[model samples]
Target: MNQIVLTTLNARYIHAAFGLRYIFANLAELQAQTVVREFTIHETALNIAEKILAEQPKIVGISVYIWNVSEVTELVGVLKQISPELVIVLGGPEVSHPPDLPAVCELADYVVTGAGEKSFYDLCTQLLQRQTPLNRMIEGVSVPLPQLASPYQYYDAEDIQNRICYVEASRGCPFKCEFCLSALDKTAKPFELGAFLDEMDNLYQKGARNFKFIDRTFNLKVKTSVAILEFFLARMDDELYLHFEVIPDNLPDDLKEVLKRFPDNRLQFEIGVQTFDPEIQELISRRQDNQKTIENLRWLREHTGAHLHTDLIFGLPGDTLENFAESFDQLVALNPQEIQLGILKRLRGAPINRHTDEYQLRYNPVPPYNILSTRDISFSDMQRVNRFARYWDMIGNSGRFKITLPTILGDRPFERFLTLSDALFNASGSTWKIALKRLFELVYEVMVGTLLVDSEQSQTVLREDFLRSELKGRLAFEETKPLTKQKVGKGIANKRQKMHQ
Candidate 1:
């Protein structure tokens, strides 16, 4: 029986918890007595507690996050009630900030805040050795990159075969964007390149193909980025997919040349252009050269085969509806593979809280704590934009209506789409539960019946776009050739399928 069990309720089973694995790998002498167990938020807290108790673990560590805090809170309560002697340790982002500790911490025997790899190992050693552990809450010391043990070697067979294995070549962020939790970090730090690559080589040899890097700035160091890219380039195949969150404005010529070498759909870049407004950027201490960022984005779209997923945040302090629309239209014009329109969230320890009074920012006071209203944007306007974001995801980002999307969103893409968003909300009273065929019909009705576009032309364009993505469906417009004969690229088809699922 395992005397120590490291467990956490992950948002999903497919997401392998990297934090727990870090602690497990660094357990040193206590490694043999320890085990890691992962469960999803869907499981009942009682059931999760029961499963952990079944292992008869004397010391249990639970990694907590905003998404799983409620369930984890209940699970911790149940564990305390059933097994009074069980030493419960809580770690991760949810418990890292002091002023915003959730109610779950009171039930926990110990809470390890911040980077818990080394601290967690030390705590486990003390508890497992029948020694009294110090303090109820311990602040984790940030272990140096080269000094800490790598967590990749502990990824089990099932993780390598099925899950999206997360590999971080670095930790921390250098830029302090007030809205982000990473803003608290002093500076970005990279792991030793040779050692990190060796770990990656081992994972690749073990049949792990899908790798998602958790580095905040993957392309910061140009030469290091090139080496990592070259490593994957030599082993490039159909199944090899790598994802990175890169600094949009920092893509130099060397990095751009290396990035262009990756095949279509093999590399995905999540560039965070949170806002295009210069005034707001200054207020948030987000130093982004808009021109350079836009230029890099254009080059990435035009020159590289990489799928671009760009982000935009609404409801910033000084952001007006008019300014946000300009940003939206600009992003649409860039023609990224996907645009993630996110509402500003007031994170627990984020410095963005400082702007709350000045901006009249009101949040839901719940998990995710999305901005309900700001000084410039009213509650009703925020609701409309929320619907606009969802509808855009359905029509624009789905890649279903390629040719017809521009037709639907006329000269002023944002204003036109906002009008359509209003029409959609007024008609359905809800944004979700809209099926593919129904959505097609809605678009046809809006464009033809309301917007007064030529009915015949609209129908033909919509039908073509519909046929491009869907395999089986009869359009309201016309009869088309069966998709069975169409030769769509394997990568594009797979992406669409995954998105819909």
Candidate 2:
């Protein structure tokens, strides 16, 4: 049986299977029989090989990521060994670069960079027709296409509704944020706006309401961004919501007026205010007019009902932990819906590679490759910030920010959690499952004691978080058991430890 298998190492439990869904839907449109399976990062080489062999696929495509490349590579090796005739293809951000992508090219027969919707379909058609492989037909910086498909290939609504649904009105970013992986290419070409609106209509019809535009900066093109916002605003209903990553300083007054007309929760903006320090910003090729960013942010808060999600990064060139904390304090005073704290992830292709020595940044030599701040922010301080990031994710992103305990936790719980998380991390000895389980257990206990007045909702959300966290652990099948309230907590903790260890 001729078959196509597309898979990815998932980001988390709840994320809709995007790449596979896209490819499968495209094939369905072409009236082709196909199967798409997804696995987590923990799914081993043997595990993947067994699944592929079982499927007896004619074609196998694996979506690669920085975190999952090693495992994916091993999987590739095993699959090739078992059946060298299997047509193996790789794609995604991890391979969206020059032809000399040693890591990707070494593992697979073909590397598909950039938007794979049209290219992937063409490949399938050729393979079926007994034509030569159309690897060169794929398009982007590395390979230019004479024709590219309309940004069709519907993102699965069922898969995207619960987690953030990422839609791209455009590709590429105009910014030069050195640390930003998205900013690698500066050509920001948008899809035809009307065509984009049509896609949005289809998605909306499919029951997708929460959308996060994958545009590097949604507001870079004032008129285009405004048009899209107006279109959504015209269609606004209680269930419709949109999130954007915008440059705070560039926000227009007219846009402010438009935003003010919506409910506070109708729109959300994740502003990357990586640092307030001018030196640091310039050093990292991030040129935000700080004064303008501040003014624009203030105006956004005062004039608009849009919920704000701001971000700050630790361990940038000159940013000490103390300096980052100061920035954090300032952001807290602004009271965004959430303050996403991220450490600098040294992605292979980011411009930050050029400045490793200049910044004196020492990083972990493994997956995620986060930096340990230099003299500006000591190793201890980096640890503190890491703990801070965990606490923020638990209380802030988990939607527990409204509780009184979050404030209490914000006041002093971070320090204690940091200590405990560190100790647990050490004891668990790189077993992320155990460390996260212990972290979640402690965080939940603290929240329950201090802020979990609404136990019913908190418990529901916490359990969901636990399920997502489970995706991070080493994979082992346990038959689904009926969970009792009394045993749920213990069961979750035990499962997490099992996955990690």
Candidate 3:
């Protein structure tokens, strides 16, 4: 019975459509006629189209992102084929910029770029009223922070119980990190504190526990950050977990004091230590104090109970394998819970595009266009690092190998791991669909046979890691058969590393 349908293919089901809710909240009189539906990329386009057409929407709006762009393009094609008159509106970061707009954006009946909460409503109203604009693209005008409606009220009971709800106290980032879309924003903008907190309390009372703040820099404003932390702390329980992306060097004593108040593992800080090289930092107009970043990371590790998930980019204008390895080793030495190794991507409108020719950069020319090669790093070498990142995630970040990781990383962490990565790929031949039990057996074999670690010590720690994993099985390497039977080069080719696509 609804005339307007808002939909998107979410990367995962647990991620509720935060943007769709914002647009839904501001729909005004059209609110009653509208419905929001979310699907995952795992679904086929025809299957998703069937569900959307079931709504009989007069105008359909699809939220697009880099991860889902490829699937969504297929969705748009199918929708047009089946329902030619069905108005299709596209919006979100993937469709916001032109010149590099993907095929799906071009196929959309209308595109709303930038902040779409208000703009989407305006476009839908015009469409339904038969006052459609001649121009296909609509520029999304920014609404004042106070005037912007809170999207939290749209979360139903199911969302509150099962999903990771996204909330933002502010919009935009003041720092001009050239690789990010937020760099295009003039400055950070905060919503009215009292009103925002009221909405948060409402969400908490309604059984929402997992909150992920989408603000680009949650720690940018010390007073605001402290207030939010204290608010959550006052209502803290074992079930309440919060996540925030904080600037690496900006933790003051005030922030630290509040951070210390939070109990263990309740808070996670995604610190952006993209690269430790000053030259690369300056190249991308990323201003970070490496010394303070190191100091703060060490302090957080020692003084606080928060889990640290640090980031490092593998490919950049000035990055070479040697320097990136140095950055990787630096992060390993700090001992964060997770070291996210991200490959540099050419976001459509990001200022990093200016460095293309000088760096000899080659992008994949696909969705989530990651850098394939640079002047200093060849394509083959980049692929090696790509595989290494996947292996590292399974071994280092998964917390499965907590007992044996230090032994694997050793003194020259990156060098040794890269060597192991090469050997792993050589043994397995591909890097996907690796069974957990099989991976343990492979790692045990590699450590004992390929890397030539002391067999007794490697088996001891690896056995501890296996026990900790709680994965019940007799490891192929640990079978009752004689040592000669479990060969390292045997059909363990079943699994390797797949760089998270």
Candidate 4:
């Protein structure tokens, strides 16, 4: 039997890791023995290497991403040293959308671009048939094959309940946000809704309670997006939860009505605003109506029970620290369920790379490749923003902030935590875990000192433990919840203050 091995880091363990089920399921018909293995680079790379070596597969395929690329590269180097003759194929979002990706050309023998379902199968067949190198085997983009199956599958319902199942109803993004790779690859080809619904049903039956749509812009197509929503609406019985990425300004009245039918906690939408500064938006080629976005957000809050997660990007071209702060304050005023503060990622295929000189942008040399600062923003300000990103991830989105921090502070003022944590971590030179612990401690102290709540630390600790247990893999979701009765009381008080003020 022909044997093929596919391995990578698990998506559930890391929030940034996207699912590879579609690739595995589509290539299932290649008439070969296949094994899929998952492990964290931080967990055990060498042990995973040993296990895969023991299998002695003919071909080894590994999915690469920004977070795990270094680990995967190192693992591949070790794997090749041991086996010497294994055919290594690399593919995924990271490799697919690079202008001149070094890892693909030097590390992996073959790099499959775009959708790998058909390309992977074709390459496997050719290799088995005595083709030495599959260099000319770039599928999907180069050759238009109708038979190319989309690789996506829902996991066992019971297994999926504990994990986040990522599904994609479409491919490609329709925007030209210069800083984003998806913007360059705009098209937004949607799949059949009935077929997608059937796939979802299979997953639902298997025990999935949480689903995240990986589509670039789910709301770009009203009819298709609405159909999927309606299908889920018909089946939603409080047991299932779905998450989507939506364009805030493009939200339709009809979809808002559909969302209203579902329980507030059952559905969530992550809207990427990037920036509210019109000049900054124009610089990045991101077309957005600042006023419309705010109005649409208010409409969703009033009409739908769905949880709202809004995003803001720091360090865009022509944006200073003051501009970013102002944009952040405005977004916070909207009172989203979650505020994801992201720094700019200078991706390879992104159009913004072409305008580096025009913008006079200098980015970091690390994994994230964030902008250092430009004429509009200073280097010191960018460093401060870096700290802001770290704290926001931990306290704002991590779900632990609401539990300890007094909600007496308005959304805009609560953001002071980001600046505070930035200053503290810079002084201590501490790791994120250590920084997070300190931030939580300080937040508690502030709450108690300010009389935000009465003595209820003991009750809050138990509640936190419960949340940690209930949502083991979903740290972001778990940490964002109000942990104590005191905190909950403070939240109510703060809401009343907002209304009255």
- Candidate 4, residue 27: the lDDT equals 69
Strongest candidate by lDDT: 3
Query: Could you give candidate 3's per-residue lDDT for residues 1-501 as a string of tens digits?
Result: 899999999999999999999999999999999999999999999999999999999999999998999999999999999999999999999999886799887678999988898888888888889996878988998899888777899999999998998999998999888888888999999988899999999999999988999999999999999999999999987688888999999989999999888877778789999999999999899989999999999999988878788999988899998999899898898988889899999888999999999989999999789989999999999999999989988888777788788988889899989988888898888678888888887888788777779987887777766765556666765666322222112111112211100
lDDT of 4 at 203: 75
Residue 112, model 2, lDDT: 74
Q: Report the C-alpha lDDT of model 1 over 212-270, residue by residue, as the tens digit.
A: 99999999888998999999999987789898999989988888888888877788889
lDDT of 4 by residue, 324-405 (tens): 7788788767767677878777776778887778777888766556788776777887777777677666555555545433
How many clashes would you count in candidate 2?
A: 0
Clashes of each: 0, 0, 2, 12
lDDT-based ranking, best first?
3, 1, 4, 2
lDDT of 3 at 360: 93
TM per candidate comes to 0.95, 0.74, 0.95, 0.82
Please list the residue runs of candidate 2 whose C-alpha ends up more than 4 Å from where it truly belongs after superposition.
17-35, 42-51, 97-105, 113-147, 151-153, 160-164, 373-375, 396-501
lDDT of 2 by residue, 420-482 (tens): 445444444532344444555554554445443354454554555556444343212212423
Model 3 ranges off by over 4 Å: 479-501
Give residue 192's error in model 2 in angstroms.
1.1
How much is the lDDT of residue 86 in candidate 3?
A: 91
Question: For each candidate, what is the lDDT?
Answer: 0.86, 0.67, 0.87, 0.67
Per-candidate RMSD, Å: 2.3, 8.9, 5.4, 6.6
